[model samples]
Every structure is written in C-alpha cells, then in structure tokens.
Target chain A: MPSLFFYLFTAITLGFGLLVVTARNPVTSALCLAMSFVGLAALFISLDAYFIGTIQILVYAGAVMVLFLFIIMLLDIKAEEGKKPNLPAVIGGVVLAVILALQIVTVSSSYSLGKTPLKNAPLSLNKAAETSVLPTISNDLKVGTLPDAKLMGLTLFKQYGFHLQAIGLLLLVGTVGVVVLSKREKGGQDA
Target chain B: MITLNHYLIVSALLFSLGMAGVIARRNILIIYMCLEMMLSAANLTLVAFSRFRVVEGLPDYAAQSLVFFTITVAAAEVAVGLAIIVALYRSKQSVEVESVTKLQG
Candidate 1:
C-alpha cells in the first residue's frame, strides 16, 4: 500500500516534470513545475521527513513557483509557438539523460545498503530518548512520537549553527546581488 | 516494502529528466526550472538516506540539515539567477539561449 502511494507520487512528479519541460507557454510550465514540486514533497513525506516535506511545499511549490510566475509575467515572455528546437541538442540530451539514468539505476540496485528496507532499520524511540539531551525531544520520543521538527531545529542549531549563519549571509548577499543586477543604469548606459 | 533503491531510482529519473530539460529547452526560465527540479531530486536522495541511516536510534538529522541548507541555497540561487535572466532580457530582449552571442568565437 505504501509502495503504491510511492509509485503514484513518483508518477505525478515525473509526469508534471515532463510537462514542465515540454510545455510551450512559460505560465503553463511554471504551474506544472509547482505540481511537480508538490509531488516531490509527497515523496519526502513518505520517507518520514515531514519537516522537509512541509518546507518543500512551502518553499518550492509556494514561494519559488510564485516567484517564477511573477518573473514570467513581469518579462511578458511569449510562448515559443513557432520556433524550431535545436534537434542535435535534443537528441544528445535525451541520449545522455537515458545513459545517466541507467547508470544510476544500475549502481543503486547493486549497492548493498540500498537494499535495506525501512522496517529493518526502524527508529527506536526508547534508544533515541536515552541518547537525547533535550527534554522536549526525549519526552516526545518517550511518548512514542518522532519529534521531527524539534530534532531538526536542535540539529541545525546544535551542530550546524555556523553553517546556518553562513547560509543566511549567502541569502543576504543574493538579495543585494539581485537588486544590483536588476537595477537599471541611471545614465541610459548598460553596465 | 519499498527499499532505499526505490527512492534512489526515482531521484535518478527525476534528475535525468531535469538534465534533459536543461540541455534541450531554449527558454532560460524553463531551463532554470529544470535546475530546480534537479536540486529537488538531490533533496529526495538526501532525505531517503537520512531516513534509512539511523543515528542515535533516530533518522540521521545531519543529512536532513544538509537538505535544509540545500533548499535555502537553491532559493537564493533562483533569485539571483532570475535577476540575471531579467537583466539578460533587458539587454538582449529575448530569453532564447541562442541570443547573447557576444561570447561566441
């Protein structure tokens, strides 16, 4: 049953992903990409990464897609209705992608660790509670729940706090860079 | 009954599709969207590995943290990329990849 849902979500994701690639209109492509992100978020949830899944929806499907649509409308991009695709690039891309996919499938199928089922490596709440330092996290674990978001927050702040700060700096720089890049020159000259 | 391989296979396929899109599509925005798809595929792989690899009897939060960072960076990247694309459009007045041939030898 779970596998059924997994396959269903994967189909949804890949199908919409294909549409995003093939659709001529930018708005249609953006909407299909949003649907693809939603499907990918479902796959994340199936893996028990509930927090990641939620943010995948919030960030990718919600914020990122909206940004894309806004940009598409702002640019007033018309559909490539009559343009001929570069045929050599299309053929090469399809062939290369197929080869890469097959290689990945082959490697993953043969990987010993990947064959392990989720049930075989179940999360032991008692053991987690034993190892946990925080009362809230340990309490949740003790009560038979996986405090995913709390644990994620703890992990981010505890272990990767510096990295988190670095990411924040990166985002700030990105914002400034966008402002600079999009700002028009005052003297009617391209900078 | 799904194993880690199932997730990996899905991720691989998604990444391949994105690769094809990036290479074949002429529209810079669609190519950018494909890049986002590729990033999401990597996130799926990371989350799957995080779930299967238990640390302290719970799913490894470290990998999940990396996924979080990846998502953040990707968002930032999209903003910067789109801004550049918009700038490109202002200068060239076209989003087609075949435009902007000043660098071509």
Candidate 2:
C-alpha cells in the first residue's frame, strides 16, 4: 500500500513539474504547478507528516498559486511564441540534470536501504514509555499522538523563537514593500 | 518498501526540471513558477529525511519545522517578486528577460 502511494505521488509530482516547465501558456504552467504542489502534499501525508502536508496545500497550492494567477491575469501577457529555445541553455540544463542525479546516487549509497525506524514505530505517545532503551529525556518530550506536528510547534516556539520573530518581521516588511513598489507614481509619471 | 532514497530521487529530478525552466524560459512569470518548483523540491527532500532518519530520541520534526519556515518565507518572496515584476511591466510593456535594459545605459 505504501509503495503504491509513493509511486503514484511521485509520478504526479514529476509529471506536473515537467509540464510546468514545458507548457507555453503561463496560465497552464501555473495550474500545472498547483497540481505538482498537490502531489507533493500527498507525498508528505504518506510520510506521516500531516501538518506539513496540510500547510503545503494551504500555502503553496492555495495562496501562492492564486497570487501568481492574479498577476498573470492583471498583466494579460500573451503566450511567448516568438522566443526560440537557446541551444546552449538546453544543453547546459541537461548536463546539470545528469550531474545532480549522479551526485544524489553517490551520496545516498552509504545509507542502509529500507531501514526507516518508523516501520514499526509506535503511533500513540503512551506506547513510547513501555519500549524504551534509549535516553528518556528526548523520548519523554514526545507528544503521544501526531508527534510530527506537536514537536514542530514545540521546537519552533521553544528552540527557534527568535527566528520566528524575524520571519514575522520579514513578512511585514515584504508586504509593505510590495504595496509601495507596485503603486504608480503620482500624475502618471514614469517611475 | 519505499525507502528514503526514492523520495530523494524524485526531488532531485524535480529540482533539475525547475532549473531547466529557469534557465530556458524568457517569460518572467514562468521563471517565477519554476523557482517555486525548486523550493517545493527542496521541501520534499527535507520532509522525507525527517520521516526516515530518527535523531536518537527526538521525535523527528526539526526538519519539518524548517520546511514550515521555508514556506512562509517563500510566500513573502513571491509577493515581493510579483510586485516587482508588475512594476517592471507597467513601465516597459514587456515580460521578456532580454528587454529589461533600462540599466544598460
């Protein structure tokens, strides 16, 4: 069952990703990107990271893509039909893709295959207390159910509070900057 | 058995495709979409690692938190980036990469 889902999500994500790059119409590309994001979210859910999967759909597929579509609509740009594919760029991209594939294979060759600890890992928090041979400090911190989301919140708020504050500030600045930058100059003058 | 390597392979392929789109496309919007694709690919790799690789007794969500923060920042980035693209379009009436030559003076 797990393997089937893994293959399905992988196929959809990669297929839509390919379409996003190859599609001529910008709108088509944007929609394909959304489909790719949905596939990615499913992959996350299959991995048992429920919070991240939900946020993946909410943020990337919902909010971000909508922003892209709105801009594309506002601009009303035509399909880019006149531009010819640059031979050198296409060649370089293929070369880079080959290099990346080789690098990942080489790096991951050391890890034991199919050795994920979650294979028989307990799902409930209470079960963790009964099967302990490791340090109890970290294990004790684990929340019983939905550990991924709970631990994420704990770590983000406790260990990385300052970083979260910085991100909030960054978002505020970005929102203001976008508003200011997109606004037209008074009297319809050139910016 | 879907191992960690399988997720990494998919992510690597997606990243490469996004890279190709960024390098080959002339339209600014398509490039932006590709950039988002690349970000999503990275996020997938992170989530996969978090799932399979246990950190001793830790509940294996540190990497997931990182992905969360990354998504937040990506949202902010797209907003600002699209605004800049819109501003450029207003003045130049073109979205092609080669046409933005106001600084070439």
User: Best TM-score goes to which candidate?
Assistant: 1
Residue B21, candidate 1: how far off, in angstroms?
0.3
Worst 10 residues of 2 chain A by lDDT: A129-138
Q: Give TM-scores for every candidate, taking all chains together and pairing residue i with residue i.
A: 0.98, 0.88
Tens digits of per-residue lDDT for model 1 on B56-78?
78898999999999999999999
Candidate 2 per-residue lDDT, tens place, A1-191, comes to 77888899899999999999889899999999999999999999987888899999999999999999999999998887877777787788778877887787677656675344346433445554445443443365354444455567767988889989999999999999998998888899675
Instruction: Kindly list the per-residue Cα lDDT of model 1 for residues A1-191, writing each as its tens digit.
Output: 98899889999999999999889899999999999999999999988899999999999999999999999999899999778889999999899999999999999999999999878989889988998899988999999998899999999999999999999999999999999998898986664
Question: What are the candidates' interface root-mean-square deviations?
Answer: 1.4, 2.5
DockQ of each: 0.79, 0.62
Cα lDDT of model 2 by residue, B1-105, tens digit: 667777878888899889888887878999999999999999988988887755543346778889999999999999999999998888888888878976896
Model 2 interface Cα RMSD in Å: 2.5
**Model 1: how far is A175 from its true place, Å?**
0.9
Residue A191 error for model 1, in Å? Answer: 13
TM-score of 1: 0.98
